[model samples]
Target chain A: MKKVFVLVLISIFFLSVLSSLMGGVVNIPLKVVLEVFTGKVTGIERTIVIDVRVPRIILATLVGIALSLTGAILQSLFLNPLAEPYITGVSSGAAFGATLAFFFYLPAFPYLPLFSFLGSFLTLIMVYLMAKRNGKVNSYVLLLAGVALSAFFGALVSVLMVKSGRDLHALVFWLLGSFSGRGWSEVKLAIPLIPLLFIPMRYFRELNLFLQGEERAFELGVETEKVKKLLFFLSSLLTAIAVSVSGIIGFVGLIVPHISRLLFGPDHRRVLLASLLLGPSLMLSSDLLARVVFSPSEMPVGVVTSFFGAPFFIYLLIRRKN
Target chain B: MIKVHDVWFSYEEASVFEGLSIEIEKGEFLGVVGPNGSGKSTLLKLVSGSLKPQRGSVLLEGHEVSFLSRKEVAQRIAVVPQEYHLEFDFTVEEVVEMGRYVRGGKGEHILEELNLMPLARRSFLTLSGGEKQRVVLAQALAQEPSILLLDEPASHLDISYQLELFDLLSRLNRDGLTLICVLHDLNLALSYCKRLILLSEGSIFAAGRAEEVLTPENLGHVYGVSAELHSHFGKPFLTFFSPFEKVNEGLQIHIICGGGSGSLLIHELYHRGCRVSLGAVNTLDSDEVIGRKLSLPMAVEAPFSPISDETHKRNLELIDRAKIVILAPLPVGPGNFKNLLALEKAVYLGKEVWVVNPDFKGRDFTGRVGEIISRIKEKARFFSSEEEVLKELENWAS
Candidate 1:
């Protein structure tokens, strides 16, 4: 069953990758898209596929994988099925930092991601302190604190957007989350940070034991506090880098991991690989929907994902209740 | 092997154990039995390294448990906790495989060893309580530790499952894995553990072989109940009772019985605070055992001997002093035929006589029994069982 699901995901991933490159305002023919792969196409077609659509497709796929893997890791780390990458308030914190950078006209190329990462890292620390009682981190309290901080930071972002006069379009697009006009630079910014996932993947067995309950995991020789800390750093870093580029893409992190778990199994090793595949496919398809549904005026990819992802999540909840 | 030295442990404001010390040998199956709040579960946690004592150390294999690394400690000891509640779904195989996290495998052999092979693919949440316990036990065993700790593993199990689980543990103990189990059931502890430690007031009140430690005195004082320890097929079985209340309602009764007929009546009357006595029973008879157990005053004689002249005189005297006399159904034997004659003396004294099973005609040893029967029938009330006799006695008092 797992093998069949993997095969199907691999095929859908390739199809979504191909479809994302061919669709958009400028429709590149399938023949030219295939020819570009063979290095035979040049001129405007080459510019459209290589310079424009290719990097955008790769960025969407990368963001999807990063976010979905973050969700899977966070869910297990928190021992909560409802946990997601953005639930830690990293998305809001990063959005505020990016908006601040845009408002002050701070050098957009390098300072934007750095400020975003700093904002998320500080919020993580604050959430950590708020959730902890004495010396132990309480999972439920952490969740509540994350939500409260996210709302506070989201209000700050909105106030900054409202106060700014010139960068209104830029701020709203960043907040809505999109891969529009993204080229190799945006992909380059996220690719180097993708290896942050290696830190969490190495502790798959420890993460598996964590699902057994924290005290039981500790009894089984898992350094639970240290593992949780390291995972928080890595997952927050991954989500921060993704949001620094594409803003706050909703539900990909929340829904893709769940879909992968349902299709595969709850074992972290398998779920990690399956969600990695499924996340990109879901994101690229949503990006495709964002491109063609409005045609000339494109919808933000975040809006397109939320449009479908919210209902799918609700369906999952109702099915589970039964 | 484990040793707890001068362990002073407290939970919040209450002190559970203070200056408590114990030593356990390798390959020994030890049972910790105690009343509630006696620190039995606390002792298990201390040895498992999950709890650090406020003022002492727990040593496993000559090394302090707290000083050891997590992997090092876990490799030596495995704990089967009191409950297993996982919100996420994992198969039985997956749960058992968690034990091998430090090491690595699917833990297939451990599942097979515990007879969980057929259910390996089933969802863990779908299993029954006993099956879940077995899965947890299998997971702990997969750790391959030298020492195993269980906290009331059978407390939630039904009787058949409890026995089956203990039987499995006994087999494991025989295979030379040291076990320290906290058992709520004293009889289970007595039957399974090679040695027992009885705890009270956060200290070891008694510790030794099961038979020596589970004495009636130890149980009665620690648990605040009267009890007796009897041997059953080379094992100790405990019988418990409420403390003896001295009731002086000032009612007196005498019983005439043999062949184990009046044992229940004597025990009931003794517990109900009636001044009761028995007459002319041979020593070591089954009814005499009940009388001795309850410490009742009775006229006794040698076994296999006819009711002697002296015993008959004592029986009549007992009948003369009683307000009511009960004659339990007895076979007409030459040895005890004189017991029936005491009824005539009871009637003469104007005492109420109750004959149980009056229609049992097999006991008419005396040739002149008809005259005595008709005369006594007019004065004596007939009862079919001992319960009816006690009911009549209760009515007379009320």
Candidate 2:
């Protein structure tokens, strides 16, 4: 009951903040913005508000949902608080493909999403191969090797960035992570998997067992090794798709799930459900602020999320110590 | 029946056990005793199918244990291991419920029986050690197994919990459940076990009734202890008597025993670095416990008992095994009095032969002290302190 009420409050607050940002420098009144939203108002107000900001808002929300869900699943699968989609190297691997597509003068590959998906999939397979030991992949060792592998590919992506250097503006914006270029195609690419990943992961009890230690789970006949492999493949799929179009959004894949755990308990079901609602809403509002905070010159969506997530994360670490 | 036949175990190249064999009948309680790291836990692991022996086999209900699946073995036998670690904060009920995991039934009944239902809502980390151990037991019991293997189940628990655990096992045994428990507490083993298997260095030293297997000879040989064996309540009671602190500096310890008691006195003094000598200890005598360790050149009697007068002369040669001649609590008979008479010479030489008593007169040579003070002084040398004697000998060493 309390969780539902808190969700509604957060929705109203973020919705109001997003609308005010959508309204122009002259600061259109709430009624006028509603009028524009409802198509009663005319000219540039409707075009700028409904056509431009509304689509961007929806894209930010979708990307945020994708990233947070992936983060939640990855953390549970690895059984470590620090495991995130980026930590597994999938996001950076996708970024390397996008940069390579630009390097070859194939800016419009007509399949940036497919190329990114392939790169991320390859990276997941490689990591799984490296971490597999005694027919089981231990999460601690896997994460260490994954971080090392991710850094190696991250340096490779930086090299591609230097080689492709042209179309500096678009490449830089994509690297910084933005919803500026998102359209129905990107949204259509990510939408089908949301419920696919979301609904299954929301089951609490089985997930609780999976995240607990392996021997205890085994003694209870849980088939721990199988569960880890299944969850790892599923999370990598979710993260690869999300990063395909968003480029490399940072903190949503890292900080948001941890923040949700601090607010909710460590139950993955509640943490995930909270992320579905809170993740998008927070990102949408942050993206809006990023878009208009300095007027016409837009900041990356990653910048806005990190600007809020980083300090709060530090505060969480300090507060938890006491 | 569980049959462990001619099993050998090794780690890499170092062999732990060679040709070790024992049999446990259904509904029987077997207590296994051995020195530390004597492959006792390894034996349990082999029986539980957690580890496979390199040679030979463990036959559970006449089936090769390694051939069965782990779940299949778990269904037959439940083991409560020594050190337990489980991740996450599960309630005691939830933890105990894991035992019933094979049952595929709801865990409420197990939690209730394990006395964990009341603490069901609390996280598992809040429980104390004994509580945690009970939950582990509860989990194993939930399997409803016919055979149970416990590796030091009562080691971490307090004395009351230890008694409670044995009582529970005894009750389970009454209900026709077979239990094999490894224990360090010999008293607990004596009190509860129907048959005890004394293991020395990965081999069975003795395996049978508590009375026959737990004699002073066995204690001396297997455990390197100088012990007294007496009947208590129709059961054998073995107690350690320290040869360390002399009852008086006058009484010398010259125990005419067999098996390995020689090791005990030597260790007691060697650990204290106290000097010792030995006599009339036949090669096969239990006094070998000290003889092997200290390299004491004992005036040995021949392997067979019923000491002859010539052996008595050889035994008297050790009248100087120590300053005072001490006799351990051994079942004395007429044939061994020559060894006792040799001790009388030590007494004549002003060295005292002190006997530990529940009536030292039954061996029959008792007419020296005519006055009350002299008789009192003669009996005053009887000792019970295993520690003080060792401590004094240790001081002698330094």
Candidate 3:
């Protein structure tokens, strides 16, 4: 039964990829999209399919995978159900970093992603230091520190937004998060970091043991302190990269892992695999709606996700209570 | 196989262990027992290598435990914690398989051995406390460790489950697995563990065979309660007196009881600090067993034999020394007819005589013995229950 469910998820992911490639402002058909893939088509259709839409799709998919996988690892690491990439303060710090980039009138290409990665990485280190007590990281303290630093960075971003005159519109758009105008460069930046996901995946058994608690995991042969340090660094790196490429996309990291757990159980291997497939499916489908719903003008994909993800998460919580 | 050498450990301001040392032999079932805060659990943690001592060392097979990696330690030692709560739904098999993290193997044989195969697919969070404990045990056992450490594994279980779990542990110990268990329940410690380490105020108060280590003096000193160790089914069982009871020191009370009738009244009066002695009871009688366990001054006779002149003289001497004598609602038997005669002697001697729950409607086994009871009842004050008798005794004391 689980195999069948996984197969269905894979099929839906492929369908979402194909539909996302085809459904846009020009409304390219499936046959033309296939022809473009096979090099039978050229000109505007080819540019739209390969150069325009494909990179955005890949970038969105990579961001989705990074966020959801990081969320899965964090939830198990902290042994908390509500843990996600956003809770770690990385997204807000990245947004603050990007806001600074726009405020300084820096070029968008390498500077924005670099500045955001630096901001998120520095914020992660700050939270890590704040949460450390007597040479050990307390997860509860880590979560609280994350919340406090996130609000601090978020306030700084707001301050920058109020100060910048010409960059205000760009700052707000970036803060709201979107996949527009992103191309192969962002895709190239994120794909190399994909292998980092395997670090947490390698300790899938230890991740399962962590759900019992840190002391229990240690007793069960997991080098808990070492594993915790490695996972925290890896997840923070993944979140920082994802936020750098796509500006603070909400709920994909928080909700996709939960959705996967609701479908496949809490075993990290299955949950991780499910998140790998479902993250892209959700992101692609949401991005598709973001582009096609309003036609030439588009709603930020973050708004679409939060607008739907929040209610769906609440529904899941209510059902679980029963 | 395991030795803790003069270890010092503290959690913040409170020191849990101060230069405490003990050794556990291979194939021995050793119980670590003490009151709360006595550092029994801390000792287990130190032995399991989860908590490092500030001074000295914990050695497993002559190698320092802290020097070994977690996988190396876990490959030889498995711990069943006091309690485990899983928020996420993981099946029993999956939880058990987590034990194989250090040493890779399927836990199918362990699940079958624990009789958890039927519920192997069930979510661990949904099981009962006993079932969860069993699953946790199976998970620990799946490590295939030579030594198993359990911290109050039966604390949450009901009576039957507690027995069942201990029985299983005993069977495992018999199979050549060295077991070190931390337990607060002294009776359970006595019954299951062959050797015991009794901790008191961060030090070893006593350590040896369970019967020798779990003495009344040691228990009273450490726990501040009066404890009596009795043999139940040829195993030592401990019964404790609550320290909160009012003290009535120097008040002498003699109880004439046989069968199992006087056990509770003796415990109650003794707990109230009365100097209690027993009237003649036959050997192997339930009341005699309790009297012997409590070390109360008592007269005894052969089982099912009539009370002899010598034993009756002893019973009368006990009655003479008492300010008050209580006749428990024991059945009137031919062998103990002389006890009624002693009660008459107490009444004649102007000692305060009380008959508790004097319902002789169906208790009379000898037809002639009821007449003597009736005669004694007229001279004795009759109370329906032990509570009323104790209340009246308190009034007399004041």
Candidate 4:
């Protein structure tokens, strides 16, 4: 049964990759796409496939894998089903930092994500410290602190948006989230950080140990405090990088891990692997839909994901209740 | 082997354990019992390395528990906590296999040993409470620790399952696994645990073999109740009674009993503050022993001796000093046939006479005693048990 699920995910992943490469405003045909890849095409089609489509698809896949893996880790780290990168305020914190760069007129595209990384890593620490009691993190307190901090950082983002007299359009577009005009330069920075996801993957058994709660996990020989700090650091790093590249895409992180766990069991090894594969597929499909839905103009991929992912998440909650 | 040396553990501002010390030998099944807030569960946590003491150490095989590496501590001690929530949909097998994190294996041997083979593939969320507890126990045992600690393992289970779980613990102890359990039920602790420790107000109130540790005086003083400890087939048992609220003054009851039929009545009457006197009991009778234990005055005779005129005169004098007289069910043999005559004399003296389990009809060896009891039966109040007698006493006192 697990093999069949893996086979189907692989097929869907390849299909979405193929479709996302060809399905865009320029509408390159499959034949043209194949030729461009095979080095048989040139001119505008070659430029479109190589320069525009390749980086965009690569960025979408990278962000997908990053966000979904972070989402899975967050859920296990907090031992909460509703835990995600956005819900924990890492996305809002990163976005706030990027807005700081834009409002100050710092070099926008090249050095922005460094500030974003600092913003999110610091926010994770703040939330973690606020939630700790008697040497253990209370998950409910952590959730509430995440919300209050998210709102505080969101208000800062708004303040920056109002201060940016001429850059408001860019700030709002980034806040709403998009993948437009991103190139190989941004993908190059992200590729180096992608391997850090393996750190969390190696602790899959420890993550499973946490499902029985902190004390039980400790009794079972897990260094719970160290594991928690390591996961928090790794997941925050992944989320900051993804947010810097994709401008805070929503719901992909929240929904894809859940769908993976629902398809596979709650064993973290299978769930984490499935989420890594499913993340790219969902992100590519959402990006494809965002590009083609409006024809001449594209909707923000974040908007598209929220539009579909919210109701699906609600449906899952209702089904889980019954 | 485990030794807790001068352990001092506190939570927030409240101290739970203050310089408490205990030592447990290898292969000894020990039970820790206490009232709520006495830190029974905390002691287990300290021993299992889930909690560290503030001022002392828990040593397992001469190594401090909190100082050892987590895997090292886990390899020596495993705990079955009070309860756990099942939030994920892992199978029973998956849950049990998690105990093999340090030393990985299939965990099939533990699953079969715990009789969880049939439920191995079932979702953990789909199990009943007993089954869930057993699954959790299986998970802990999968660690294969030398010492097992359980905190209130039978608290939420029904009686049958409670017995079954304790029975399983006994079997595990017999197999040479050192067991330490916190139990709320004193009877189960007394029957199953080889050694018992009773804790009160965060310190050990009593500790030793169950019989010595669960003495009536210790239980009554700690729990604010009147209690007795008895043994059945060499296993200790405990019985509890209501403590006296206030002494009902100016009331007295004299009981004529033998053959162990009046011990319970004597205890109930004494606890209710009735001045009780037992009469015409032969020496070495079980009832005489109970009467002496409660310090009630009794009219006694030699063993196997019939009630003499002097003993009868003393019994009548005791009945004369009482407002109510009780006749406990006794065989009317020729040896003590005068005891019934004493009851008739008490009724003839216009005292209120009560007959408990009145069966003087065929209990007669003298043959004429039935007619005498029937003549006095109209004036006597018949009661079934001590509970009914206590109720009547309450009514009369009020």
Q: Pick the candidate with the highest TM-score.
A: 4
The window of 10 residues in a row where model 1 chain B has the poorest summed lDDT is B242-251
Better of 2 and 4 by DockQ: 4
**Fnat, one value per model:** 0.58, 0.14, 0.88, 0.78
Mind giving the per-residue lDDT tens digits that candidate 1 earns over B1-398? 68899999998869999899999999999999989999998899899887899998899889999888888988889999987667667899999999987667888999999999999999998999999999999989988988999999998899999999999999999999999999888899989999999999899999999989988889988998766787889768987777654442557889998888887777667766788889879999988877887777788889889999899998898888888898888665678878878888888789988888876566666555566668898899899888787666667653
Write the residue-wise lDDT of candidate 4 on B1-398 in tens digits: 79999999998879998999999999989999987888899889989988899998889899988778899988878889898776899999999999887668858999998899999999999999999999889888988988999999998899999989988888988999999999888898888899999999889999999888888898887888888887778766889897886455557889999998788887877877888999989989988988888888889999989999999888889999999999887777887888888999999999999988766666667887768768987998888776787777777773
Model 4, residue B384: distance off in Å is: 5.3
Off by over 4 Å in 1: A36-47, A87-90, A93-149, A163-169, A315-322, B87-89, B115-131, B156-161, B241-281, B290-294, B304-398
lDDT of 3 at B286: 91
Q: What lDDT tens digits, residue by residue, belong to model 3 across residues B359-392?
A: 7878877777666667776678989998898788
- Model 3: per-residue Cα lDDT at residue A24: 77
What DockQ would candidate 2 receive versus the native complex? 0.20
Per-residue lDDT of B1-398 in model 2, one digit per residue for the tens? 89998998887756788988888899999988776877788888778776678899999999998776656666778878786765455667666656665666646776776677777777677888888888888878877888888888889999888888788889989999999998887777888898988888888888898777777778878777767665688866667854444323323345444444334554454433334566666666667645754576566666666677777776676665566565554444554556555655666677655544424454344333223224445533555543444444433332
Candidate 1, residues A1-322, lDDT tens digits: the string is 7788999999999999999889988888899899998999888989989988889988888889888988888777666665665666777887778878877989866777877877877777787677667444576687688789889988998888788777677668768889887898888887766677566568778878888777789778777778888887777777878888899887788788787778867888888888778989999999988889999888888898778877876675577567
Which wins on TM-score, candidate 1 or candidate 2?
1
For model 3 chain B, the run of ten residues with the poorest summed lDDT: B241-250
Give the alpha carbon lDDT tens digit for every residue of A1-322 in model 3: 9889999999999999999899978899999999998989998999999888999999888888988988888778766665676766878887788778878989875777677767877776677677657544565787688788888988998888898767566656767778887888778878767788667678888889999988889888989889987887777678767876777777787798888888888999899889889999999999999999999888888889888867875665576568
lDDT of every predicted structure (CA atoms):
0.83, 0.67, 0.86, 0.85
Please identify model 3 stretches exceeding 4 Å from their true place.
Answer: A101-148, A164-166, A316-322, B158-160, B257-261, B277-322, B330-342, B345-351, B361-379, B394-398
Q: Which candidate gets the maximum lDDT versus the true structure? A: 3
Q: State candidate 4's TM-score.
A: 0.92
Worst 10 residues of 4 chain B by lDDT: B242-251
